[model samples]
Target: RKGITKVTVEALPAEACRVTFELKRPWRWTPGCHVHAYLPAYSLWSSHPFSIAWAESKPKAQPLEIEMEKIASKNGSLSHSADIDHRPNIVTADSTYSRKSMLGAPTVTTISEVAHRKDGVNIAIPRDSAVTSVSLIMRARTGMTRKLYEKASASKTGTLTTWGAIEGPYGGHDSMTSYGTVILFAGGVGITHCVGFVHHLMLQYQAGTSSTQKILLVWSVPNTEALEWVRVWMDQILRMDGRRDVLRIQLFITKPRHRGEVISNTGSVQMFPGRCNPETILKREMAERIGAMGVTVCGPGPFADGVRGAARSVVTEGVVDFIEEAFTY
Candidate 1:
């Protein structure tokens, strides 16, 4: 947990970026787990928590993926220095300073400049990966994240390798193996969580280790760029063994680049335009119930609540469990 890792940064659309961390040692985690990252140099010694987006167990392979979003710091400097974004003097939600201090000028900073900070974009962890190898998909916002983004963008090559620290592959304990039908719902980056489960369950089903006979993955993203968030991972899952036989994926793009871009495959994978209606999708799946169904949601509060309500309405239809994976800090 105290090892230093090398990170490669690649920018993505929607002000987002991906950071691939190469661990110096081995690491392990379950599908829903996360890790705490301590970028002491970039973040004023503050450690932030982010969900592990992807991981692998191969020897010498990078094993942890963390998706990050850049948050704007209120009074941070944007001078573009490698070590200039640490704003420990500002008042924040968790700071000891009172609310009045938050409304006034930062006691330590006289100049107001835009700087990027890091924020966690909640997502899923890849299954069966060594704790040491990982990747992070993140969006650039204000202080540390912005600095990181600028550094990556300014890189002569497409990648920027830097030093980073990782701790704790935490909280992926929920399991869906006991259910015969498993339905997963995701919104935006939340699809990251569901994608790993799809891989885990599919492999288990193929090996006769899981009771899940049917798996349905429903994901809602804003646009094609957002789709790129999990394009590589989804591509891999689509090609998994017996994927078409046991798995079905439905992608709903709330905002499409073009109406024609909302395409669909005739088989197990389908794409549609507009937001996903939780109740409607739940009702349809419950109508064609398999064995004991498990409904898991990882997204916004409103969306999760809608799914929870939908799952409850159909409880009498069969044995259904609605598991929500969400946290606030």
Candidate 2:
């Protein structure tokens, strides 16, 4: 069913935005799954897939409460919360992007330099509400994503609440609860896929529903600003019951804006400078072997390949399984 974009916040790092939408109907999905969004406003035939970031625990009569610090704006103009790039690009005068072709056959303009094929939008919906709401964190790439960014930039409040449709809560089926040690690796916005698994597994471990005892979430990003992408959700996960007992998060920032941005908390949550070496991390994880280890990765092709390679190199070690999430359309 169609969902209404209720709130949109220009997330930090200048390349992304956090959007909230209220679904017309109620739906439940596994944490690591995703949803496809078809924006009729852009083009009906072109649908984008996004992971489900956060969801409501139980149905609620009230809308999900979103608590984010409002970004300042001057004269009610597009606030800092909105990062709009008004730079005009050279589009072929051909009918490629024309309304006729968009209707007859979906075609999108490709800008090689600035274009990054977005995996999909991630959503967090409230439970029990007559109208369910979801928050989507999007990075402006090319075509539809660029259009969405421009539209929001043109908004006075920097909000891009609009009419859109969602399809399927796909691919969260792999259950890691049977394993004793679970390691998740995420890159950039790929963190959306792993966030739900962390939440679900923590709850399962806390309630003693499954055998999972150790969950190590390793997230790699470009800079500190990129960290803002999942800050809100991470804050919530940190407070979950027995979270400290089962979760260990290692954040890797390849580029730091300044030396001060490279702070580490030591044990539970630690921040490191530069990229991570999969082999080193995997070997260390093996040294502290808990039980059977399940390694899952959701990120760029290179990162996924690296994780797979590392896991394969150590197959001789106890029970180690590797799962990779690839939503290639």
Candidate 3:
């Protein structure tokens, strides 16, 4: 569980949204985990899951950061979300699913932040204006999730469950380190999860690992807004290839395609959206070409479903290596 302090809006290019949050740091969190916040001020204790986009404080002078989203009011609460001056019945927190919250916000705990001053060991990362990607620190609270949900808006505590855990920074999958060309499938925020994947592979190539791994990122975004936050990530990926040939990204716009603009014109990504069909996957031809071909995905509900369906069929065909990190399984 976590608490929200300062909230801000961050941008990528043409899109903007309520993006950042100040979370209390030194709290144990993994790059892939999400903090479920409880807003008691809103008579709500349910944790709104958010990936730990980034965190600092290690090498000193570093600040911790968290990415948040404010959508078009879901539960008949427009003013509540808009009024960020800290309103009553408006407590913003993560799902109360921690050992502390479940056992009842502990008076003490240790979370992610700076390393330590004891052995003079600390990570040295330069400060930059780049929010490359958003990450989440998750909780594995499977007890009375139903009760926690019900008691939030209403009074009756039903039974519910959230089975997850706190993981470290996502350096990406073990497969990314392998040689050979790689075809990547990322749906939604799945793109963010791949920062480590792309970076590590590129680094390996630069280090002369002898394993020239080519990558194709097929991304399906939720809307134009989501793309904005991701544009920075895209821009950097673009520069990683001096010859501009490091990674190939094929982005699909599933829900919002406007005015014949399949994708934004910066050459940031190749665009298309809609469910990722088996046909699309088939066209990629990984199934027919054997020898070290792998497929991976990260995205929203439908995109995830599409990936599973298409990839399931491909795996059965026994030609491609399908790797997945299920957000909810």
Error of 1 at 94 (Å): 46
lDDT of 1: 0.68
Cα lDDT for residue 67, candidate 1: 12
Q: Per-residue lDDT of 1-329 in model 3, one digit per residue for the tens?
A: 23344333322322222233433344332223334444333324344544444433332232221111233244444444464433223323221111122244222211111111222211111222122223332222343332333333242332212222222333322535453656666665556455445554554665566253566667666554455444433433344433135565565666653433343333434555464564466446654343555666666666666766776665655445666766553
Candidate with more favorable, higher TM-score: 2 or 3: 2
Candidate 2's residue-wise lDDT over 1-329, tens digit each? 55544444453345776765566666665667778877777766788888877665324353222211122233465454567544434432221111122565433222111122221222232221222655566777888777787777677776656677777767877768889999999988888878878877876775688799889999998876666667766655665657767888888988776565576634677778899888889999998868999999988899989999999988898899998887345
TM-score versus the correct structure, for each prediction: 0.75, 0.74, 0.51
- Candidate 1 versus the native: TM-score? 0.75
Q: What lDDT does model 2 reach? A: 0.69
Q: How does candidate 2 fare on TM-score?
A: 0.74
Candidate 3 has what TM-score?
0.51
Single out the weakest 10-residue window by summed lDDT for candidate 3. 108-117
lDDT (0 to 1) per candidate: 0.68, 0.69, 0.43
Worst 10 residues of 2 by lDDT: 110-119
Flag clash pairs in model 2. 49-120, 50-120, 50-121, 54-124, 59-127, 59-128, 60-128, 60-129
